[model samples]
Target: DLSEILSLHDFEAVARHTMNRRGWNYYSSGADDEITMRENNTAYQRIWFRPRILRDVTKVDFSTEILGHKSSMPVYITATALGKLGHPEGEVVLTRAAHEHGIIQMIPTLASCGFDEMVDAAAPGQVQFLQLYVNADKSRTKKIIEHAGKRGVKALFITVDAPQLGRREKDMRTKFEGNASSHQTKGGDKVQRDAGAARAISSFIDPSLSWKDIPFLKECAGDMKIILKGVQSWEDAVLAAERGCDGVVLSNHGGRQLDTAPAGITILPEVVAALNQRGLLVPPGKPRFEIMVDGGVRRATDVLKAVALGATAVGVGRPFLYSMSTYGFEGVCHMLQILKDEFEMNMRLIGAPTLTDVVPSMVDISALKVPTVGNTMFGVNYETMYPAGV
Candidate 1:
C-alpha cells in the first residue's frame, strides 16, 4: 500500500500532513528566522553545474572510502537524535536501511534507543560512526566512548556547533520542543523523567575543548578514527589536523547554528586550499585526512560538486529524516539508491572515471563571484547575501 505513496518530494508533503503540527514544526523548523537554513539550499542553486559529455557512460562507479571505511557511495547519513518519533524501530530502521545501501550511518549519542542495540542491529562491518554531543557529565561521555569502542563503531564525530540548541522560532512559536531528558523507549536511564516540558537543553559540550582536548579524545577513542564536525574556517581545519583529528565535517549544523555563518560549501574550498598547502590532506602512506561536508545537499549534482571541491565525502541531514517521516525504512533506502544512481550519472556526465577525477577544473568557479562595497573588497557571506570581512 505504501509503495505507491513513494517519491522524495512526497515524503516531506506526507510527513507534514501525517505528523502533528507541533512535531512537524520541531523537525522542520530551523534556528532564528531560519535565514541560514534558507540560504543553505539557495546557495546550491546559485552554483550551476557544467556537465561534460562524450565519455563511456555505460559503466560508472560510486563506491568510495572515508577514513579507511568503504561505502557504496560517498554519502553518509548525518546523525540526528530521536528517530523513534518517526517510527517504532527508530535508529534500527535507519541503520538497517543504511546498511542495505552500504553507506555510513552516523548514530547520535542522544539517540532514543541504547547504543548497544543500534550497533547490534547493524549488519556486521556496515560502517557506523558514533556522534557525541559532549554531555556535561565527562564520566558519562567517557562511558559512551568506551561503549562505542566495544561496539566496533568505526569513527567518532564530535559535533561542536550545538553547545546549546539553536533558537528555532517556529518550534518556539508552536511550543513544540525536543527534550533531552525524555525517553521514547522503556527501561533506559538515558531518558529524562518528564517529556512535556519546554526549555533549552545543553549538550554538555566542553567550551574548554581546545587543541588541548584532541589528545585526550584520541586516548578515549582507542584507535577509532575521530572527526570534528561543525568546522567552518581554514584556521579550524588546519588546527584540527594539528590536534590529530582524522577529518573535519565542514558544516554549520545545517545552518541551525550560527544563523550568519557562511554556507558549508562556501568555506569548503578554503579548507581544501589550506589542506593542500600543508600536505595535511594525506597521511603518512594513506590518503589525506578527509574533508567532508554537509548542508543543503538535495541533489546528486550537489554531491558531485562537494567531491569536486575536495570533500572526500558528504553528509545528508534533514532530507533523509524527511524521507523517513514519509515512508519509513523503505523510503530511506530508496532515497539512498536514487542518490547513488544520480551521483554515478553525474560522475559520468562530468567525465570523472573515479571520485579523484572530480577536480576543481570539473567545477566552473567563474560562475562564482565576490561582492564589493564601493572601493572596498569583501568576502561574500552567502548566508546574508551580502559582503562581510573586507
Candidate 2:
C-alpha cells in the first residue's frame, strides 16, 4: 500500500480512508474556521525557488544538527498528543521510527503513554526533546523537568502559547458525545463529555505561565537546552533569547491554536531580522540562537524554504502520523525515507550541497504576503494534485 504513496498527500488520503472517524477529525481539524490551517500549506505556494545549476552537487547531503545532535535531515517529529488515538503502539512507534531515521522526536506531555514509557522505549543515545505544558502545580512541573534531565532529554521546548486551548470545531464535533474519556477522568475527576479530546486532557495547562518561570524551568532542566515552542511574532522571538532561552520555535501549534495567526513561514524573515538587529540572533560569545518553524510543511521544498529564510530546522507532525496510522512503524519509516530522498534531490536541484548552503537567496518571498481564500472543505480530505510529468 505504501508503494502507492508517492507523496505526503497520499499518506493523508490513505489514513483518512482507514483511521477512525473520531481520531481523524481530532487530528485533521484546526481552530475556528481553520483559515490559518489552510494558509499554512498555501503560503509555501507563494514562494518559488531560484535553483542554481552547474555546481558540484553530486553528493547532496541532508544531514543537519539540532542543539548539537546529528539529524539526518532538517526535520524532526514535532510533538502531537494522544498517539493511542491513532495506533495501538502509541507514541513509542514514533520513538522507534525517529531513531531508525536518525532524527529527533519531541515527546508531548499529553501523550497516551506515560513520559517514562516513551523515554524508556528509546534506543540508547537517541535524541529526544520534551514539549511541556506548564501545570498549575509548580512542584509537579519542577519534578517533571527534573526527571526529564535525569532521563537525558536533549532539550525542553516549553510551550508559550495556548493560555487557553483553541476551540477546534472538528474535534469538538466528535466531543466523545455522551461518553467520558476514561483517560482524562482518572481519580474520580468529573467527566467532561462535551469537551473534545484536547480540552478533556489538557484542562490543566497553566494560563499564567509567564516569562518569570523561564529561570525556574532552566534551573530545573539543569543542562538541557530550554526553547520556547509557540512563538509567532518577532518581538516574542527576540524576548525568548533575551530571557535566557536557547531558541524559539515559530509555530502556531499546527494551526490548532489561534486561527488566522500568521503561518510560521511567512513570519520567519521578520523574526530573523529582529533577532539579528538586536545582535541576539547569535550574540557574541553566546550559544547560537536557533529559530525553528513548523506547520504547513509538506514537501522537502517547504523545509528548504524555511532553511533559506533562517530556520535551523522544521518540525513535521501530521504527515508522519498519517503514515503511521496508515502503515504502522514501517509506514513511518517509509515516510521519513521519502523525506530524506526529497531533501537530497531538492538540495541538488536548488544547488545546495548541504543545509548551510540553503541560504536566504535560494527563495523569493515577494509573493508570500499575497493571499487568497483556501477551500475549507479540503481539510477533511486531501485533494491529490498532479504535475505535468505525472
Candidate 3:
C-alpha cells in the first residue's frame, strides 16, 4: 500500500532518496551554521508541557480565528513554491486536500499552476490565502494582488522575509534547478521555462521599496486583509500594524532568508509580547494585529506551543512538502489530519479544551534569555526593544 509505503517517518527517509540531492538540501538548509534552525527545535524541546488530568475533553474544539477568518484549525499549510514538482497535479491536488481536511493553505506566488485554477479545484471559498513576494516589477506585484482580489482570495499574505534570497549552501553545491525570481505564484509575469527543466534566475528584491511603499500596497490590496509574512522583530510588527496591515506572520522565512537570524519560534515571544504591550506605540483603536509564526514546527504539540506563545496561527512547511512528495494529495490530507488530530489530542491532554484556554504563560520561556524592555537589559526603552517601535 502506497499509504503504508510512506508514513510520516518514511516521508523523511524517502525524501532523502527521491529528491534531487541538492534540492532536498536547499529546502532543508538553514543559514550560515544552521544554529538558529537547530535552536528552533531545541528551544521547544526545553519547554515541558504540564498536562492536567480528568478534564472534560470529550468535546475538543480546535477552531480559531486568524485575521477574523475562522479556521477549523489554527495550524495551516505554509506557502511553498513549485508544487508541480512535488506531484503531477501539484497545487490542485494540495488545495483539494486542504479543503477536504478543513485546514488553511497559504498558496505561494511562485506556484507552478495559476491561482484561479487552484481556487476552482479546492472547495469554493476555502480558507486559502495567497502569499505574495513583491517582484522587482511593481506593476507585477499590483497586478497579482488585484487578480487575487477578483478571484475571491480571502487574504493577502505579503512575504517580506525574502527581500533577498539567503545563500542556500545545499542548492549552491548541487546547482539546484529553479529560478527564485519566477517562482512567485500570485504575480502576472509568466514563468518562461525550457520544457521540463527549471529556469535559472536572480534575486527579485526591489531595493527601491521604502516604508512609504506600504501605503501604496495598502491601497492596491484594498479590501483584502493584509498579512506581513516575514516580520521577526517587534518594531517591524508595530510598523506593519501602524501601516494598516491586518497581521504580521512572525517568521524567519523558514530559516531560508538569513543564515544567522533567530528562528521563528525563538523570536516568537519578543514579537508577541511587544505587540500585546499597551502603549502609545500603536494606534488607539487599532485591534491588536494578528501574530502568526512558522519555522521548524515538526509536530502537533509544536503547533500548540506556538499558539500558547501568543501566535494566533502557525504554519507548517517541510512536513506538508514531505507528504506531497511521498503520497500526493492523499498523503498531504493524511499528514494534515495527523497534525490536527495530534493537536486536539495534546490540547486535551494539556487540559486546554479550547484554543482560548492556552495563554502566554502556558509555556515557561523564562529559562531562555528572551530580552524584555521594562527590565532594561540595555538603556533602550521598551519600545526600542522592537525594531519598529511597538
Q: Which candidate number maximizes TM-score?
A: 2
Better of 1 and 3 by TM-score: 1
lDDT of 1 by residue, 26-64 (tens): 567777778878777776666666666686667788789
Candidate lDDT scores, in order, read: 0.73, 0.84, 0.70
- For residues 1-390, could you state the per-residue lDDT of candidate 3 as single tens digits? 455643355666777788665446655666667766677666677656656678788888999877777788888888877665566566777788878877788887767677777778877668778898776788878988888888778788888876555665554555435543333432444433332222223245565666778888888888888888888777888788767788888788767667656667766666665665645234478665778888877777887878877788888877777778767877788777777778777888888889887765466555554456554432323233332511
lDDT-best of 1 and 2: 2
Write the residue-wise lDDT of candidate 2 on 247-341 in tens digits.
Answer: 99999999999999989988888788778778998899987899999998999999999988888899998997888888889999999988888
Task: List the RMSD of every prediction in angstroms.
Answer: 5.0, 6.8, 5.0
> How does model 1 fare in lDDT?
0.73
Task: Work out candidate 3's RMSD over C-alphas.
Answer: 5.0
Segments of candidate 1 deviating more than 4 angstroms = 1-7, 174-205, 283-286, 369-390
* Best-matching candidate per lDDT: 2
TM-score, model 1 to reference = 0.87
